[model samples]
Target: MSFTLAIVGRPNVGKSTLFNRLVGKRLALVDDQPGVTRDLREGEARLGDLRFTVIDTAGLEEATDESLQGRMRRLTERAVDMADVCLFLIDARAGVTPSDEVFADILRRRADHVILACNKAEGSAADAGVYESYGLGLGEPVRLSAEHGEGLNELYTLLAPVAETFEARAAADAPEVEVDVNEDGEVDADAPRKPTVDKPLQVAVVGRPNAGKSTLINKILGEDRLLTGPEAGITRDSISLTLDWDGMPTRIFDTAGMRKRAKVQDKVEKLSVADGLRAVKFAEVVVVLLDAAIPFEQQDLRIADLAEREGRAVVLAVNKWDVETEKQQKLRDLREAFERLLPQLRGAPLVTVSAKTGRGLDRLRAAVEKAHDVWNTRISTAQLNRWLTGMVEAHPPPAPGGRRIKLRYMTQAKTRPPGFVVMCSHPDKLPESYSRYLVNGLREDFDMPGTPIRLHMRSQSSKNPYKNKKKSTPSRLRKHIHGRGGAQG
Candidate 1:
């Protein structure tokens, strides 16, 4: 049984600090500047035998229009609505401001249960601010210093009761199940290891700024879960959500837009880009979203190449397709440009989509599933050796220094972006073009297009067994000869 707690307050009041402390990890990005967080990041939190989900949301601003701050405020409000309990934090050192008072009123009217906390209450400097917090009429505020890790015991005391109530409610609402006992008088709990309904496919949607990443995810979610506007670089964290995508269990990540290295001078943007890179590394499949009007730019090619180099199964998506007038020609040109620019990802699926209209998402999903399948593909040693024979017969390896490079044996070393090892003579002499040929053949013959394939060439040289053994001495030989002559006599 679990409940969700959303830490809400004005910007730079230590909401993310308290969130990190409660969750026992730095999952949420924190900085000295205000408004570093723009998305709702959720993590599992534990405190003194109490466990729950904690949401780190954007700061609650006074904006109510359709601007970036307004959208962020709306997103924070959504978090408040979803959470079972709300932790409204105020700056104890700075004292309660008008903004804090306003958000407190909103929480009072919105949240079912609210825990008012005065953060930065570590010394006498914050004493006056702590006392002034009583004017808001929420109750006695818990004195907390999230950075110094003080006052969490009191926070736990307040949370224990609420956690108990939620636990009881969950237990009552849960469906009953029967378990079978094995011969050893234990419950048979072993399950299959294959991907099933319980396990979800991990997919990360990544691209440059203003590429409609957040908008696309929102369309899939059928809600404005993330803050989005005409502004570039609105997202600064890799926000992930789980759902059944096209009847398949999936956990998709909406990552921050990546820009050229020279243009990213801010520390927060650097952290954001590093976070997105980490998301790509963890993902089994990466979707590189491109704007249809300007598809396959230098940055786009670099991003796709980055995914390929990281060994992530790649899927190309051209966004804002509805806005394009010459659909057929544009798609053809996009394909040609993709193949020419990213020859490594020659046969990868390229789908066109409109994040605003929710078009071609189904095809995108299918392409992702297929790429994942190919990424995890495993071929037998027998089939691989047979294919290697055909490849060698068609175009034999080059002979460097007049010695033929015999292709002896082939076997798959691993899967998940299938890697193959080839044992041959003078493997060091194999040219790059020849290696590319073998790789392309493996991709075509093995039906593993677009997925990166690893090919390793090694020389299988036989070592002499007696090379290091010392020869018998002349004295021992003479003694043996004398003994043989005496025996014969």
Candidate 2:
């Protein structure tokens, strides 16, 4: 079902609270403060068995000017236009204010389907407000407490028909397959694990505050889907959106700016940083965005390092490249800095692009795909053994305490950040630098660049055959020697 449900209302109406309840996660950053959400965040939401894409949008504001609130309001309105249904939420405790009524009228005109909902209606204190919601002319409101998880069944009941339509469409759109029936009425077996077309490639853009992450995303999306402004730390939620990028179905994440850990003071900012880290974990490819003027700050390095440590494929993007005067010199300097600062992410793609001007986006896209391919690269056992043999022969493992560490065999243990298991003698004694040599060889020889490689050195756990042998006492040794060799000399 591609249908989308957007939650919209004035600030602090529990719209985000309800969004979290539906998505079954704290994907949206919820706070007591108003206007926390400034962008449209989409998640796979399940209300009972009815599955749909749910959007957590910025609060609908009274302002129509180009202020921050105004931009936020515009973003929410865009969500209304894009969604199949809009869940118009209102604060039951506060009653239906003028702002809520104004948004109600806007939804009436824009949204094809609008579902009126009064949130925080858990007790009798909200009854008056719940009753007052009927005056907005959007029909009887669904009273529920988003935080307490009440009235979802009623909400599911309303959305069931829409879900049914989704199922019907899905069935209708399913591609026809040629069935091969045998004499026993058995069908031919397909591939054990076929790729799911509906599953989009997950990519995340992460960086420091005001690094143009949202702007870069908007450029890729070819629309101002996210709220972008000059203010630092404007994005509080790790918002996700799905789009078709150059013939590839991709789900992109716009994460909050991650500043230095000690500098993150506000509770909401901390939550936002946590949310971005979650997004990094969930993503297959992470684009570490950098401002062209200040390419590799400490925070930027930390974010990139975090992605690398997470075993995610990384693509380095220098945003606002169009504004850089010394393009060649800056590119060379950026590469050197990247190598020095993040040796772990060595050989990763570092493309320059201007998010504001949409320049070099094609190259950025190519780099991302290339990095993903490298991340998922797998080598055959025979090939890996050959490569390992060559690597060991070229520069053998070091000898410590007169015992040389021997690498006996090598095989790929897994892919998607390719991991290898090396069967060797005295694995514990093998130096880390030798492991780096093997990993670097694997990268260069197998053409797996910029992907995090996990090298596991394993030694057999078998015990020595004479481990339980009894030691000879002094008397026993003397008796044996005397009995065997008293007259032999």
Candidate 3:
């Protein structure tokens, strides 16, 4: 394992900003608000040639049991315990407070190694607060500014020796391997492993508030990794977790509940919704979770349609299956409502599950895996052309202005929400209904249900072979005229 560093400090001390700087990406949500980060987020951090695992933790609060802030404190304390070294930050601009002193004492007693950092130390005005940080008795504080990328070299110098020790330990602990020959006469140890080109499938779970989106993820992970309670919008950030599901590596993003835009008046909630939309765009498959008791609400339909419009593979998950009575009637009603309300996701997988009871989770996983595969489905050129030919023969193109529009060729231009391009005559004349028919045919013929299919029609340009030839009088007409003149003479 690489060396681990945890950034811990009181609220609003710029721990997250520094974490984002080190990770070289905006993985953690940053704002002026305190307690924006309520969970421990881990990222691989780099400082020049030094690389290590860095964790951005929730601000250390004095609370220690049961309340929300208490839970957050416990989580941060866990990070402190797991880390090889803790970078305890103090806001130089605001100076040290009682909470910072409390945390400093805790780290001094608990952490194996501690590095004091005074953030917002770029300006001369911060000199007094920088001096005040020395009273924490940790060490000479490393004056730094995380936002402006200042003082990283000093941070690197402190971490270099730690990284070297980690590397040395890893090299020493590596086990020796014995080579063996296989039945095919090849050395088993020398045989190269195939490089994996496909990344972990990205899935985003989204729905209205209190739709059990987080519950479903917790059920799948078989743990309470996400904080859940009898409250709406408990989750504020789009948190991504990696797991092994059914022998497949999957990265699942549990986003904040998305309510209708008109009802969302708060700035933080709006940011949460925007973050959820971003997750949908990044995902290969999106599971639109719905409360089974109140399935297909207007907001739910809107969410599903949004996923479809984003060209993402969609799977409808009706959560709270255990609470619903009259299972047969409920299923029938759900199917009808789904078909009538969201035809854009026609033939998509509609799975019913109880996140509370862990029922139907297997089916949900199966549906997600299947949807991901279909999203990446690619049709061969020959197969696509043949299917196009059959579709055209079954339902010929519209003949506008008494001219038959010819569709000459067709091919798939791309996959991952498969897209096709067709060369035809008068592509503009083709009706939207015809395009829908062709897309439906492609879906049905290729057995690609629930996957988006894109089709493009291009009018083939007509060529004239004799356009370069000068338009001289016909030879026959010239001969007839000459002959007539001779006769008249």
Q: Which candidate's TM-score is highest? A: 1
TM-score of each: 0.91, 0.88, 0.88
> Using lDDT as the measure, what is the rank order of every candidate, best first?
1, 3, 2
User: Which is the better candidate, 2 or 3, if ranked by lDDT?
Assistant: 3
How many clashing residue pairs appear in each of the predictions shown? 0, 0, 0
lDDT-superior candidate, 1 or 2: 1
Q: Report the C-alpha lDDT of model 3 over 137-181, residue by residue, as the tens digit.
A: 998999999999999999988888888899999999989989787
Q: List the residue pairs that clash in candidate 1.
A: none
Give me the displacement of residue 209 in model 2, in angstroms: 1.0
Clashes of 2: 0
* Local distance difference test scores for all models: 0.90, 0.87, 0.87
Q: Give the distance in Å from residue 434's predicted Cα in candidate 2 to where it truly belongs.
A: 1.5
Task: Put down candidate 2 lDDT per residue, 1-489, tens digits, no spaces.
Answer: 468899888888888888888888877888888878888888889877677899888888888898898888888888888888889999899998888878888998998999999999998999999999999999889988999999888898888888788789989999989967778985434212112348878899999999999999999999888889999999988888888888877889999999999999999899999999999999999999998887788888888888989999999999888878988988889889888989888899999999999999999989988887788786789988888888888888888899888888888878777889999889999988888888888888888778899999999645688798997679988999898897796
In candidate 2, where is summed lDDT lowest over 10 consecutive residues? 187-196
